[model samples]
Target: MARNIYITSIEGHAGKSTVALGLLYTLSREAKRVGVFRPVARTSNERDYVLEMLLAHDAVDLSYDKAVGVGYDDVHADPEAALSRIIERFKAVEAQCDVVVIVGSDYTDVGSPTELSFNARVAANLGAPVLLVLGGQSGAGVNRTPEDLVQVYTIAHQELDAAHAHLVGVIVNRSDPDHLPQIIEAVSATAGADTPVWAIPEDPFLIAPSLASLLDAVDGELLKGDSELLLREALGVVVAGMTMENVLTRLIEGSVVVVAGDRSDVLLATLMAHASETFPSLAGIILNGGFELVPQIERLIDGLDLSLPVIRTSFGTYDTARIITQTRGRLAADSPRKFDTALALFEQHVDSEVLLQRLDLNPPLVVTPLMFEYGLLDRARQQPQHIVLPEGGDDRILRASSTLLRRGVARLTILGDEGEVRGRAAELGLDISGATILSPFNEELRERFATEYVRLRAHKGMTMEHARDTVTDVSYFGTMMVHLGLADGMVSGAAHTTAHTIRPSFEIIKTKPEVSIVSSVFLMCLEDRVLVYGDCAVNPDPDAAQLADIAISSAATAAQFGIEQRIAMLSYSTGSSGSGADVDKVRAATALVVERRPDLAVDGPIQYDAAVDAAVGKSKMPDSEVAGRATVFIFPDLNTGNNTYKAVQRSAGAIAIGPVLQGLRKPINDLSRGALVQDIVNTVAITAIQAQGVAADSAAAASLAASTTTAAAAGEQS
Candidate 1:
């Protein structure tokens, strides 16, 4: 059966088209065959704009006529017949693709009192999960209050449930950032844990009216520049009536300036602003009031290479501005930049992996290693982070860096001699120009870093000279970059031992205050699921306290990557079936986790079979929550964890994407000496995600401190 998702909204212009486009782009990267079906389009132009955009990007193979369903008028005339036709059309597309995205009707002039009911029925008939896109602004043109958002979610949920369709998730689109936290809290509380909620902050660029859109809205005549150039987006509008200096201040990048055509001075100033480096590039200029420029001025404009579009409108500046403001830019086929902006917005705001999981369309029943790696790359690219690779001299590292850069997963800094690195890249036929190359020994900051290093290790009697020598090592240099916030994170160990790779981080970066011991986890990308195996690369034999700490750290690492924290403390026994020192250690660790972090779902002293296979798990430990659904596994010792991860990697042909060290103040991951190019790419992605979490935590701490200080001052004043 083809898994389908219906992208629908409560009203018109709620950004459902952008959401559908973004989802199609995301799905195309993972699935081989994907198609789109708009169940009820607004027009009968025989050209679907959404379908054309997808085809322009080569995201889909279907034609526009085949992708579109009945028109709005047809659906309005006969609802039942139209729905049946919609279902049939959906099935036709489903037959040709592995997954099909069904776009719901836009609530417009063909509006019926039963529009919502009609949409719900279509979704139910198609047996597709619905992703609801709710506009953040209410009818009052202000940010929706928490109560208002909750009510919207409640109404949609009730309607979807009534139709017996799954409400996969809710996306609060075009939201004001200031009101997001409260709205998110309210919606989350009302929607419950199973339903995910995401809020996308308003991006002016995404919704900005293009020059072409403005011209069409006001019925203006183009006086200069190509019609194609006029398609460029105008992020803001400036009415030029003030002095040149004042007007220049109001002109932002991609802004259209409206002025009288006879005001040649203002026109000349606008042209100069576009040409100068001191001012932002203008999107276009609108000459209002039916005034034409003089022949000399027109000749002057022709003499200059005027790239900005100039439009002549019969209306006044105020009326033209009003028309432009009312124009909402559509994602046309030729608007590649706008498409990119929409994709970035959706990726940044919508958690695609979680959304796919909710739609039941990803991590296929038979998950190959390729699918696992694709998921990692997709997740990493959603929010690119800077990751430094210390083993830049290695061929594997260079090749992986090229792949990472090409895929837009992470920005990288390779630590090596620039000449040698470029030469190596040339030899490998790899383009690594996107990565920053640096030599630790030749950098101007070597001495400054050495001084900081001495201060960090002064308790251990580190002299300045000793620190200077140590800072020259690439591992130490990369770790220092992370500590000083020059780089977000570091990945090493391809050319060094695990101890050599992580020692600098331990000495300088240290561990988080909440953690007593640092540990490691290998993300075992199994056939059907990704599992976290911890204390695998560090801590040879930890005591019960350290084991408990490892479990906590491993759970955190798993959660960071979107994996649910169902922890299984692995051993030879299944729930007291055997007795030994190792088994006792696992039991103690499980007890500690329950006491210290009761929020985590953990069970222990379970065999591997019981931890993975549901039938065996039920037969062995029937009452355990973590037994069959364990996504994170904590072994008793390095001998078990390391050997188990490798065994699984080799025997099952799985992709092991880690040895990601956890509980560090900063992220510094290690790769195997025999790692492949893809392995390095995966590790770098993991490090970037770890860095993002650390940064977020720091920001939250700073915000809390500022709030507390304000409260204290207020109390004193009172």
Candidate 2:
């Protein structure tokens, strides 16, 4: 039952080590039996600390005959022997644990020596998921050339994928606070959002390992910092999980003495005695069974001068070692107060502010009402400010509301009836005593809606009863609330089409009067870059005028997000390379934009790469500002826009954000039919900001127009 998780790095010193340790430690806290394997090793000194910790903690379970340490010398001098030996050790360790953490070597590219590839092969052999680790260093975000990061990631991904390892996510460790925004943006732009990036903050505690601590804790050595041995962090060991023979070898050569707490004393003694030979500078021994220490074993350990730190836990040693292997330390950037330490740590490492901006707001822990129900919502409500429910008033939403309110996510609104709402809530496990419920049936508002309904109905010669009946549905009420500024926003469409959800808003709120067309834009965020893609959701076949409006709207959106506008009107053909209706559409759209907004920099009839890649743009249209370096792309139409955006999202491994509604009188946004809770929260926040900005701009523009009109009238009168 061991889940094999791989730990890799994009480049050297990105703190994959710390990430390995943290994940292992966290998993250990959850009581999962964990083991670890390293297919490659460079330094025996590093090996000593790593192995010693493994041995002392009973952190690993596999038994190996040969020593646990694999050296760079071994790799160069006897690579085949080293690889086979490491692989064998890994197989032994894997057998005894429920999960295995595969620690990656420093080789960032494909030409990984046999040792590294074998480690990946071992992960595949054990059928474990891979969690790639990347180190975080201050200024590394802007300092490291983009090419370097891309190359590193591309290689790491290639290796893991080639090994057929199921990469779960990435851990960006030692994340600096100030550079967080840039980093998150970069990673999102580079790696895509599907790959979760867990930013591990630097912990001073992990950095303060004394020489004595090193001797007693890990299986590593003084590389260059031997004089600062006391300052070293104990480098935990890697024990393979293939079989008993492999386990036995690790027991002997591994510096950290590890024995499954449940295993017989003879086995513990066996591993200890074996490890004592190669790793004479052994740190400590770990007992895995959560058992009381035997005095005789303790005396032997003390006499051996192998200072061991014994962690008493019920989890087996193999799993424990896997967890330990991932418990590397973090180093955050220097900060002198301004926030609570934990929050500061979160801000420094997680970069909450940058996360907020990159995510368009604070990330929400969201849950689905239909699937997870109260259980899911309860968990989500604990961390976020808003709770979004799917369109239905069921028992789950009400029950979850009590938890939501208690957790102070600020707002909890359901998607169903006022009449049956309380009953549904009561039917579920909801405590509605202190809950303030709002339903679609506000009598006063209902009456007011009836009046508006009658007028619209009168225009159509419909009766009062029919008019009242038509206005009673949740969609109508929800739409009215959004238009009337009663609620922040409403998400509908599980039982409705995009047109159905949007039609109600169009009827009530209408498009911005100045704007000829309302459109949608998709935000494409890759590793560290974000691109705005317009006409992706709306305007299936817009004319020149509509295209111009779409361009302006998209450019405005980019500006809102601090992206300098470089507009590219995309088509199937690049610069008339292919001529057809599609090419004509793009050409006309580009011309219309230039005519309407001469000041705006827009170019088109371009391919995807040409629009985004500088090299491609330079070759295709040397004189065009947007040809090779556009951040905002205006697709010819929704078919091409939607399809291309999705293709990029699926194929190129990009995160597609938004179908952010544009040219609306107010900010009314739409969510995906299968949107997560965080998606809802993020869309809402972005929409809110968009709405407020539009409102302010409208007021300013209107005032300016009025002033111009007055002056013109005065001149005419004179």
Candidate 3:
């Protein structure tokens, strides 16, 4: 059955675009022919609607029926009579597509309940499902209530159901990371299990294009703003069916038409040209389901000289356009789940309880071998590395293994009995038996191991029998390889705790003398943006000096990732805004670091927003360089650090990369117990980079000392 998607909102500024685009993107990936149609759009100029059509069109490569630009003639008529004709337009757009995405409009002035009715009317006419976008924020001054959302949902659902349209879910957008937990709790209290909540993250990319921006982009002027027509609300289009006639006729006067790329032909182009000429107030066209623009339409565009621009998008442009109009451009960063990674990001900012209820994902910061393997696989695709898998693999393991090897990411090592491993590989149709498979009970290791084992045993004052038994495990071989310079680093821990993996290494390969502690840093990468959170894994409750150490260590680590570290000592307060023991902890930690290393610049006792947002930093603690623009956050305690890092990840919708271990004596790193193949690859690269840095530093210091000695000797001779 075709998925009937509808876009709505509880109030304004609750990112409808983010949720709408996510659906469009995901569905397009599934190869569906989708359409978008808006029932009612109040904008007169064609440009206001062009961006939505263009983005959906270009981003997904979906061909759209030429969009009709809306003008004064269509909207000046009686709103009721006009709406009927608009509904007819929507029906026509819905007729040619499999899935129709309907966009909604808002009545910001008088709070007309009819605005809600209009959305229901469109959904009811087409029998589509509805999704509403809402907004919430932490701190006072923001008002988001369960009752408000419930009322909106209830009213829209009741009307749509009566009209035969389904209500699929609600998306909360643009929420404050700090208040995400509260908002989720409220949503759960109101929306029950049946209505899924997709909290869209704060994506400035989805911020509603300003009237001025639209005007500038299309070289058009806004006919109305606060005085004439309130531009604060969003516009939604609706597609009620898959028939072209139905979709086109149902299109409201100001609606944009979304057609699939594969479906764009002469007939649809003609229809769009006719619609644009007939309705002087039509929005542009959006191509849905990712179809490339054909030359025929490009020729038509040149011949007709139509004012309306065309946009190709994923899913169906018509449905996506409908959603753009339906949601009223109120989507925010912290809204409901619109993207896959979006859910992961929101889970971090939200309360653990509320997060668990909203999305069924709870990442235990525990590093497992499975996690390491997965990580290694990802890294393998991006770069070359040697990835090790545990003996006896399943389909999941085999698929990951095959992909990594085929991609030439890393050399593969399977630890198990050769015959059993081959059997398992054949069962899964994977020929990884060709990989270097070593048996734990191999006699080669047994005989050679006895020789080295005896030597090491005598050196360490132990018996040969005891040494042989102790080093008999496969992990022993793996660690020994690293010790013997066979492998650069060893990443294992799918079934082992961090300590379990680290213990063997600590005993066999001791730390460097200068190293004081072992800690970890999670490299949070958001596209081109990167931030580092340190000691999140090893240090539970570090002292002031220890935090200072973490700050220095994380900064150095950031340099390895090509990021300039402007450290922020994260706390609940901003520059002593609130006083508490926790605040004091951060303050003292900041002081100790300054005292210990006067050269290392660091600032702390600031909130999360200030650390990342330069504007916020400038506004709050104007003098501190690290306040609003900090890249590194040193948390007062592990509880706050771990939770805050994850919260920023989920709530702010940021990507959290590590728990990259730091301050190791050598370049040995531990992987999560549940690590993927990619994780292993990244850990290895990171270790290599760290090692390379150590090598460079040693060389530079030696060069400096040599130059100094030569200069001194020349001065004595003179």
Candidate 4:
């Protein structure tokens, strides 16, 4: 039977999702088949942000419906059936996984006086060990003493203990860091020294509402500035009723200044403050009273390029202030920063190894495709890189750019006519305002880029005139932007040929120093796993040495994307079973790979079936580790690789996320000519990740673990 652990909190906004996400991540590192289940939901149509985050992070494989239980309405209508449905769904998840992380209900809906009781009943029925989370601050604010935390935990423990559910631990979440030690000491002393008690310090970024959240709370309308700015965390809320000097003194970074719409002086002062470095940056300015700004002030605000979000609400200043204060922070799907921060906090505070030992969960290694993609997005957002999309005229490109900006994936520079792009965006109802739109044909940029291009290709006898004409092309211009350090990487080919897209890059950016040839790999996201198919879209027919290089490069790409590297060099024959030109080439390549990269687990002259099918692989090469469990497959030629990827994509119903080109000095990815919006988005994200120069070094992983351990140790000391 799969080990089951239920995560429940005493009340809403108790940071239950943080605990669940942290547990899922921790368990996923060891568990091959980890599943998540939410026993009850607030609404039927309400999207489960926890489940979405898990899926996005590649922590769990269960679908939303199976992972989440019946809606509150259905449960209210028929309690018994709802419990049965939840149990049935949970069992389905449990049967498929080594461990199941079940989440209890949030007190989202009204008239739920027995939410805790309901959770306890479900925990008892599931016979799962429960990890109760309690809000450390309590109802008053962050003034809760150590005794207050212990009291809350004691009450929760008594309730779960009475329900006959095993209480494995208690997590005191959103606690003041300054008092974390006292709280933990108290909880341990009172609840029992042997019992596990973890205190997670409150993170302002996690608890603070974004400008958009505040806007929604007040039902405000966006009056000026970029909507993308609304995603900024509102760290402070200030009502601008006082004098300008008083407001300035009180302002902090990420402060939301609430003022009446007619308060032009306050509005102008706030904008100027944001403009000046003397004062902290303003997150946004909220205009209350529904009073329209005077024409001159409105024009002045519009003419200036303000990065701060400005919103207008119908409510008066005090009411708006009250609403902003009362609005609870939520973990939106787009907020990767908060998710990462939460995960980091959990990892720092909780000892996952101890938790797993208590839960009696021992899972094996299983890498799912979703997990791979999630890692890609996570790494990309860790340090956002600048990416340029040259084919901004295309609606798909525009849409992808908007999505990237909204998700905080990358800073984008879309190469096109600003007016035309904006017009197209308006027609499509796309928000590309966050993106920097640059005209490739702009005289000044064209001249500057031409001069740089001439200098770069001057050895080839290229003149300024020829350079000027070349730089006019969006591809050349975009590539030049990367070359000039204006952008980190570029993604094009939506309306251009492969040669046209890669030509400028090859000319200007060039390949890495160690790489003799450039190759491409399609991250074949199959039903169960993510496999790397190498040289799929680049080299037509690589020599033995080139093939070996491709294998090494492909392995690095796999590791960069969080795919463990076990390379299989594909041919028509397995081992020394056959003697042919193709087999000989693969055998030579395999030898070179072994010679060059001895640390890499690579085997070659292997047939496709033997590479993938365990039974066939064992029959052919019984002692080979890379044969059956190959996560990276190296094809002999482009024809074979391209055909195989397309066939598997169509026949197996796979979602192939790449043909992600590798071995450039800087990242420059090409998209399929017929690529959809999501494809572009994924490609752009991949490009941004690649630009970060993450390598395939186990030392890097070791270093990260060391840092996490160090942080945990520091926290313990504190």
Q: Which stretches of candidate 1 lie over 4 Å from their true place?
A: 44-46, 55-57, 110-113, 225-229, 242-246, 362-408, 412-718
Better candidate by lDDT, 3 or 4:
4
RMSD of each: 13.4, 21.1, 24.7, 9.7
Per-model TM-score on C-alpha atoms:
0.55, 0.45, 0.43, 0.68
Question: Which model is ahead, 2 or 3, in terms of TM-score?
Answer: 2
Candidate 4 C-alpha lDDT tens digits along 218-315? 99899888787677677788888988788778887667899888878888988888776567667789999999889999889887767567899999
What tens digits encode model 2's per-residue C-alpha lDDT throughout 1-718? 4445666654555555555544443333222345666655546344333333333323344433232536556766876687677767766776676556566665433434343455556456656666666555533333343344445556677777787766666555655534555655666677786665555554433443233343333343221111322322333453333344555555422234455654445435543543343322332345555665567765664555432333344556566675555454333212101011223233324422332232222222221121122222322333332223335553333433443343333354565554456444422223344444555566786776667656644757867677566556766666666555555445555445677667666766678776888888887765445778888887888987788889998998888755679898887788867898768877888888888789888888888888888898899888888887788988877788888899988887666767788887766667676665445544544554564575567679999999999999999999
Every candidate's lDDT:
0.82, 0.56, 0.55, 0.82
Where model 3 places Cα greater than 4 Å from the true spot, the runs are 1-398, 431-434, 443-466, 576-585, 595-599, 673-718
The ten-residue window of minimal lDDT in model 4 covers 422-431
- Model 1, C-alpha of 337: deviation from truth (Å): 3.4
Instruction: Judging by TM-score against the true structure, name the best candidate.
Output: 4
Candidate 2 TM-score versus the reference: 0.45
